[model samples]
Target: MGGGRWTVVLDPHRWLELRRFRGLYESGAMSLREIAKETGLNRRTVAKYLSGRTPSAPPERAASDRPRRRVVDEVAPLIDAMLRAEILLKGAVIHERLVAEYGFTINYQRVKMYLQEARPRIAEELGISPGELAGLHRRFEVVPGAQAQVDWGDEGKILAHVGIPKVYSFHMTLSYSRDPFCCFTTSQDLATFFDCHRQAFAHFGGVPMSIVYDRTKTVVRRHVAPGEAVPLHPEAVAFAGHYDFDPDVLAAYRPTGKGRVERQVLIVRDHVLAGRAFSSIEEMNAAFTAWVPLRRAKVHGTHGEVIGLRAVRDHTALRPLPQSPYVVAQRHLRYVGKDCLVAFDANLYSVPAFRVRPRQLVEVRATKSQITLHATTPGAGGETLLAAHSRAVGRGARVVDERHWDGLPTGAGRRVTAGGDLPAPLQQRAQDSSSGSLMALLNRAAATQVEVGRRPLSVYDELTGTRPFTTHPNTKETP
Candidate 1:
């Protein structure tokens, strides 16, 4: 055979053969011809493999020399612009915008491939570090009782079989000790959120110096742009002020700021909820209580210390709780209906008819157990408490107090006997007054009065000695 240069491509089978041949040749147990016969390769081929230049790893396949067309090439500039504007822009969002705004017809796979190559280049141009763009963050440590992180997990449909539409898990992790407190709830309202916080503090036996949280509406009044001041909810501020703690709101789009509680959320789900069914929120909470001791006994992977023992240090360092916990209420403004009732939460709570007029605006403060209605504008008497009632458990319920309707008519004056005649008290008042009583004279005078007849204007004018107008028959006009 005429060959300038030859290469042997050793696929897996040939590589194993080469290994066997090397073993046999080194052992000196068989001749090259005999080894070739055993391997079904010619003696020269077997000897060549035994020489062992480790079958120059099958010549790396050369890349294509021809130019290849890509569907995403035309949209490269658009993708680059998006990545530049928001350095953390996701590939899926870029694909969606390309399809919707730019009428792109390429599949997502091509867009994803293009982004895999283009994202780094653009991020580098914008001076964003590769680690930052890759979501790499440095771990932080806090002193005992210095901070606590709070987050909410959507345990959707976990309790749906029991008629609850949704369920949520509130998680609090002490930053230093990795101490965890979680409670299940059916609502995420302002009142329930702080109530859970109070429960967590009670469980920990103290409150941390500060609590970290996401930009939840219950904590933040409104969302602001990055680097702008975040406005805290008035109730949240009041609650924190009462407890002598500060609220730390995490930055927008940054969950790693509170990664401790974030990881605890998953751990809790794995330990307590997986493969377990709960009929009520109370039952779910009880399960968590049972699992806490087990969790505390284990050495934390990050800190390498027993969680319960570390929590002892954490608890000792925390600030003592206030003498009395702050009261949390969800407030709303409603006008009194014509029926003397104010509607809230699909239920009606009554206001005293005398205290609140129809259509008067009032503030409704709803706590866990009671609903209190207060007049928005107190009168000169400075009376604001209109009425209070137990919160209704079911919808379309009307909770009313009978005393609130005391002044309204109840058909008592119009009551009649079985014979269709007035009752005794009304009959006595309606009977004739001829028994020499004081009412008799008034009745006699009224009976003797005569009826007055209609009179013409001329007759009245003549009686009063005044001039009367006379009309001429031909002119038919008065002068």
Candidate 2:
């Protein structure tokens, strides 16, 4: 502590220094400046540092001509070897090994600092700070029509009767423009999965040059050769092939690489999905469609103040969408009822009297506008024509033989007597219960009337009353 620039003072020495400084100023033997110079500090700083100080470290070491024992030469080589071998991998481990192997005792903290200064840790201490990650979405800049990013999201529904306040989401973003689109689906089943993408692209007003998607089952094979990526699922691969654009599957576990799409999902979640609800997926989609135009009109963070205009500008470069949105996901298998009616959903629609008894196996390709049925394998009797339903398909409904001559529904009692019109016994059972009763009758009612479709009431009656229903002329039910 003597004459070293102001020393760190401890306990009694600090009290002594303060006393000495006070005594000196009072006695006038030496100016504060002289005391400070002797202490090897400028006057004011010395006063600040030493005025009330007591010497702490056993006085300062006198001038040392000799070097201290070499910590580096003794330990650095072993540390280097461990690092090269990627062993003794951490500072604590290195310190422990040094002591265990060479009796080289070192402070744990000092070793930690030394390792930090000497080598880079390959593993990240922190992949991203939450604040930085939060701001990442703000960092994205996209080009128009060049790329699209996609991910699955939750659907939010208010009164879904399959029973839950459920909603499902499959969302997409334009990579170049950062424009976003999201839609709902009841299932990730192939049909709805592709339908969602179709809806998203249509909302964007164009397809992207490339579509970036995380490897959902719809798109990925789920297995791969070592060091080789898994292939896109055939259905998705086919969809992409049809569009003539690259289908970019993001690397597994690397959201950072697909940060743009990831960011867009958050955009839609915050601006669109959050706090939003719908009576059903259809209603939710209607709301989503309405919001898309507003979102499209918004200015991007890094880009100019307008949106849809640029979308239009870059849209021309995008591959044109298909004339048909179908992905050929249709399956051909006959679903027949015991009464010889075909079953789809829960409804039983009639086939011709000859065609009934056992359901015919027919391949059906369903579209928004048509259900084109084909004879995948003719019935056992070698039925000539696959039946077609006059009414739309629903569960409990049937597709009848086109040549069945429009016979009365099997359960239909006497015909309306006048063809071209239904009979009165076919009228809703006057004794119909508080709930639903029959699928055929209900489907028929639904087909005939929409808003007041007795279908729901009849279904409630059917489902609630009994596990099964009594049989009538054409249809069978539990009593």
Model 1: per-residue Cα lDDT over 1-479, one tens digit each: 11522355546754554464465468775678765655455566666657764445432222468543345678888888877766556666567567655888766655676787788898789888544334676799999999999999999998989899999999999999999999999888888899999999999999999999999999999998888999999999999999999999998888999999998997787666754578999999998998798789878999999999999999999999999889888889999998899999999998888777788899999877689999887878997788999988758999999899989888877853333444467447646545434333334443345454698888888899877566555885546
lDDT of 2 by residue, 361-427 (tens): 7565543333544566566788545555543633445455545535536565653432233445644
- Candidate 1, which ten residues in sequence have the lowest lDDT sum? 54-63
What Cα-based lDDT does every candidate model obtain? 0.80, 0.58
- Candidate 2 stretches with Cα past 4 Å from truth are 1-143, 160-165, 225-234, 255-257, 280-283, 293-299, 302-306, 322-327, 332-337, 341-373, 378-385, 388-479
TM per candidate = 0.60, 0.46
Candidate no. 1 TM-score: 0.60
lDDT of 1 at 381: 90
Of the candidates shown, which would achieve the greatest lDDT relative to the real structure?
1
